[model samples]
Target: MSTATAASKTWIRTSASIRAYLQLMRPANIVTAWADILAGYSATGLVMSEQTWPPLLWLLLATTGLYAGGVVFNDVFDAELDAVERPERPIPSGQSSLKGAIGLGIALLGLGIGAAAQVSELSLGLAIVIAIAALLYDRFSKHHSLIGPINMGLCRGCNLLLGVSAVAEQTQMLWFLALIPLAYIGAITAISQGEVAGGQQRTGVIALLLLSMVTGALFGLSFLPSVQGWNLLPFTLLLIGLVFPPFLQAADTPNADMIRAAVKAGILALIVLDASLAAGFAGWPYGLVVLSLLPGSKGISRLFAMT
Candidate 1:
């Protein structure tokens, strides 16, 4: 073979390998994770101005690592199952190695904690908790129908808190808000259980109920002086429009494809949920910043799987 041709082949191989790792990270989901940090930071009533940008930047990087790590470990733990049920996945398909995935997961998780440590001890603590919760869900809790969703929810809840910890004092006052994402993610997790074999109608119903409660909580927050009630309405309605239809369809059909569709919509709609929260806490501009993430996430989702 000619030297030029060999180099071209090498480049192609490297690019393909990089794509595999990106796939493992679920780039679309990572984009949604950024919205969590943005919303959390916004909840503190802090401006994302030049002076405060450093901390916000740190928290965003922290979540990127945390989310990427969490999902990488998920694929690591599910390698055996994927080999049978999802053979197209990177590890199962030989695009990425299990040992490499483990190393990547650990490094990403460590990066998450370290980045948070740059912000404050409190942020570091929350990052560590998120990492632990993610690993627990991936390795053990995911096997249990009841505990699985809650465990997954815990990771997302703490993730939002990680953003709040940007201002140590604000976190103390706003800690309870984490429950919103917790409940929302819990519903998503519940619906995700049926991705392969199809979900139960009751499970879908329960998830829908949780979603409703989450919506109610977001709406109730609008009544607070810190939140702009009108600014929140558009994103809240967008969220409802994005998630409810798929979830309702899954609830009615309870089939594999519909369940997958519901799970995808829920995961992607996380940005919308966070945008609503940001708007409620900060203003429409900040909320729009959060909502802007949706397009990139959607574009990437077309290339890589969300669930």
Candidate 2:
């Protein structure tokens, strides 16, 4: 081949490979991790100002690395299953190697903890704990019906705390708030198991409603005074609109395609959850910034898998 032609082919190959790795990290899901960190800031009443920059920046690094690593490792562990169920995935399709995924995951996890260590001992400690939970969930507990979703939820809950605790001690209120995402994601995870084949998911629908009700209860009580002038009713409505619409759309049939739709929606809806929390607890501007990620995440999802 001509030199230019050869270089062109090489560039194409490299671009394709990079896209595959990006799919592995699942950028849409990563936005949810960003929400977790933002919620942490909101929990501690840290506004989106210069004063909050240091810890917020570090926690962002730590959570992203840790969350990305956990996801990468999940693919590593699920390679065989994906081969059968999702053969188009990067690993089984040969777009990326198992070894490369492993290396990347470890690097990200290490980067995450190291970033946390830059913040404070408590942050480092929480980062380690979440890392352990991620490892356990991916390696051993994922197949367990009860343990899997709970384990995943714990990772998210700690992620929120990882942000809050990075700069200051977590209050009892923050602890309570963390459980909202935990319950939401855990319920969604429980529903996702049937995505491969799909079927009636009445229980999943009910679970979603119950979780929403719980979150609504918290909003109703006005347990926070961090953000002002954001109406509770409208915020609650927006939260429901952003979060439950996809799941509700899929509820009628719960078939494979619909279930996949719900699963993907649930994954992206994490940003809405985060935005809702930030709006109610931090400020509407913070919530708006978090919500703005939705478009970018959607744009990326078109190029790669979100779930």
Candidate 3:
């Protein structure tokens, strides 16, 4: 090939490589991770404050690394499985190399920990825990029917706590709030199991029940004295509206495609759930700010898979 032709081919190869990595990172799901931090920070009543950007920005970056690392490792670990069940995935389809995916995962995880360390020891510790939980789910727990969902949930819960670490006292007092995401993500994970092979109606029903409990908790939290002025009802109702139809449909159909749709809706609805939490703690304005991420997340989901 001539010099110009060779250079053009090299540029095309580089562009394709970049797109493959982005696919491995699942950018749309990473947006939901940022929502976790915002919701937790809002609970500290510091989301919109003047000093918010410094720490909040770090946490957002940290979650980008953590969530991206977790999902990348997921694809890495499942490369063999993907070749069999999802031959179109980056690794299986030869769009991304396995060795490069491993390197990317390690670097992103280190970035997650390093960014959190810049915030505080508490944030660092939570970031470490989140990383460990993510690895656990990716490597071991994800294979277990009972532990897989809970392990994934723990990663998300600790991510929320990483946000709370911005305020030491609030972190101590409000750690229990992490359980809400735990249950919500756990239900999503459960629904995800059916995404490949199809799941039973019983599994979908269980997920719906768990989601209902999560909604109830969100509504109850809004009634607390500290959040008395802001109403979480609108956000909570929005969450219900976003998630329920697909969830119910999946329960009725229980097919791989329908289950996948339900899982996608659940994952996207997570941003709405985080918005409700933010609005409940800080007020509707901040809640709307968090909710604003949804449009971008949804748009990206169209290009990159969210589940």
Over 4 Å off in model 1, which ranges? Answer: 48-50
Candidate 2, TM-score vs. the true structure? 0.92
> Which of candidates 1 and 2 is the stronger one according to TM-score?
1
Q: For residues 251-274, what per-residue lDDT tens digits would candidate 1 score against the true structure?
A: 999999999999999999999999
List the lowest-lDDT window of 10 residues for candidate 3: 222-231
Q: Which prediction has more favorable TM-score, 1 or 3?
A: 1
**Model 3: which residue pairs collide?**
none
Candidate 1: global Cα-lDDT? 0.92
How accurate locally is residue 177 in candidate 1, as Cα lDDT from 0 to 100? 89
**Rank list by lDDT:** 1, 3, 2
Clashes of 1: 0
* Candidate 3 local distance difference test against the native: 0.90
Writing each residue's lDDT as its tens digit, candidate 3 over 24-101 gives 999999999999999999878776679888999999999999999999999999999999999999999999999999
What digit string (tens of lDDT, one per residue) describes model 2 on residues 117-180? 9988888988999999999999998777667778888898889888788555554456766577
Clashing pairs in 1: none
Q: What is the TM-score of each predicted model, taking all chains together?
A: 0.98, 0.92, 0.97
